[model samples]
Target: MKVEIHNVFKNMRYKFFQTEDGIYYIVEIKPSFWKTLFPFLYWFFPFPVYKVEDEKTIEGIQTPESWSFDKSSAVLATGGVAVFIATIFRGKIEMFKTELPLYIKIIFLIVMIFCVFLIRLFVNKVKFHDLYKHVNLKQLERFEIKVKPQSFKHIGQMFASYIFFLFFSVMSYIMFFLDGNVFVLIGGAAMLIMFSLVVNITVKEGLTKIEFIK
Candidate 1:
């Protein structure tokens, strides 16, 4: 089969053209982390899997293939937000039974802040603009930019940032109201580490693919 591949990282749509068959297929590859984690979760949980062929298909497909997160970065950001929220609520619930201390809360806040900083750095490094120039398409292939993302799309990035910040804020308030508990501090620290690692891996994968294009 005569094939042409276009790396559309910014659009999150990889276009594939086949000349011999005179057919084109748009294969959507998940971001590296999503690719890695989701299958693992599926293996253990045995849940249904969903994928989007294109932006339009994302809205209409019903059943298993209908629902999907935007991309790998989006999945990571959502995970970060969940971790932040879960940590705060869990801590608050525990506080009613036992009081936590201040020093521990301060430490947790510091670690969460550091994790958020690392996530921001990762997000900056994964800019879609950098990938625009590197995309390769064959001369004879008929392809269209299917997933055009807006410039202001990055604003949603603040959701991840603010989630971490809110986690810190909650910890601070809890420290003032009650003592800092070891379990909450440890849970927050664990979440921070996980977030940092996930963001690092996601950004690294995007950079690696872009480098391959260059």
Candidate 2:
């Protein structure tokens, strides 16, 4: 398979391809900036995007190389759910002291975990259309492509994280209003570190796995 570059938006574009094995490879093109910066900031970015423009040939060999794991999808969904739940409950806990019942906190955490698991399962099952239609006899002849999209999953996760941080910031302010406790400041800093680590690890692992598959 041969890949041709198309137009890009914010570093993302479509890839045109024709497989020698009679399969059509419609892939998303990665933005050059994103790809270059991915190694440093993989956690904040979303899954790349690719599209199928046309098919040149149709060979019938199932190629494993053409089918790569969508780890970014899973990470985004799971992370987003986590951040959302944390932000929501943290806000509630801060606003209404009476609402911070132990049972409620436990229930909220359970729900968040369940949501993350569901998102992970959903991402695992995602598959690109016509992904395996382009495997040729020679492994070297296979076409590999990449794309970067402003993924909703990624954006949602990032937004959720932002909310979580905002919640902490608000808590810090509340603490200052009450008695100027330093613990709130420390807690806010801790949250930032934890969130950054999670994002960085998830993105790096996801992208690494995808590249290995390709």
Candidate 3:
């Protein structure tokens, strides 16, 4: 889908325009409902969704690629969860080297494509923990900004990712034996997030960072 950035407000939230087959879609990406309620949740799991202008229902499912941020985030979080399990079982593997199931292999291939595409298009659009040069700061005072820098596509992507990961987990039963290797699960997740971050730095232009890949 071709999109033209229509407006960008402080904290990097606003509306963007997409024209497909002569139909105009205004996509809004902002703080999620949960984030709005909890405020602090945005720091750990900021869920964003996409919505059509004047529409109440979220259509994040229509364009799943835009939601790659959620996919990456979910992968990392799942790895962390697996790590905790492995630690409990006293397993010592930093990475999982088991054979991949056919369906899982297919999903993983798609994940690879998403990873590459993300670095090219979506990751560059994210602005988490952004530093403003011109904004003056007082000595020893904490710099604060209310709005977080985020792409309009984030919210939808968030939900889409959750559904996919849940399916993957259920199908494999987390690979049955993964319940044992604490190091492998955690290491695998760390590697995945690290690779995504590296791609963000290599493919994404301008300043490089290792924050939210939205």
Error of 3 at 75 (Å): 16
Ordered from best to worst TM-score, the candidate numbers read 2, 1, 3
Candidate 2 residue-wise lDDT, 153-193, digit = tens: 65566556656755765566455335433344445445533
Off by over 4 Å in 2: 1-150, 198-214
User: Model 3: per-residue lDDT, tens digit, 14-126?
Assistant: 23233344332322233333433233344354222232332221132122343334678888998999788767756334354556566665565456445544553343345
In model 3, residue pairs whose N, Cα or C atoms come closer than 3 Å (at least 3 residues apart or on different chains), thus clashing, are 48-155, 49-155, 49-156, 50-156, 67-157, 86-182, 93-183, 93-184, 94-184, 95-184
Stronger candidate by lDDT (1 vs 3): 1
Q: In candidate 3, which residue ranges exceed 4 Å CA deviation?
A: 1-129, 134-158, 166-179, 187-214
Worst 10 residues of 2 by lDDT: 204-213
161, model 2: CA deviation in Å? Answer: 1.9
Tens-digit lDDT string for candidate 1 (1-214):
1234433333422323223434433333333445332222211221111222334332222124444446888889989997998877764655544443656556656766676566645654553233323322232233322221112332244335536644754564455345445455455555544443332222211111110110
Looking at model 1, the pairs that clash are 100-179, 100-180, 100-181, 101-179, 101-180
**Candidates arranged by lDDT, highest first:** 1, 2, 3
Each candidate's clash count: 5, 21, 10
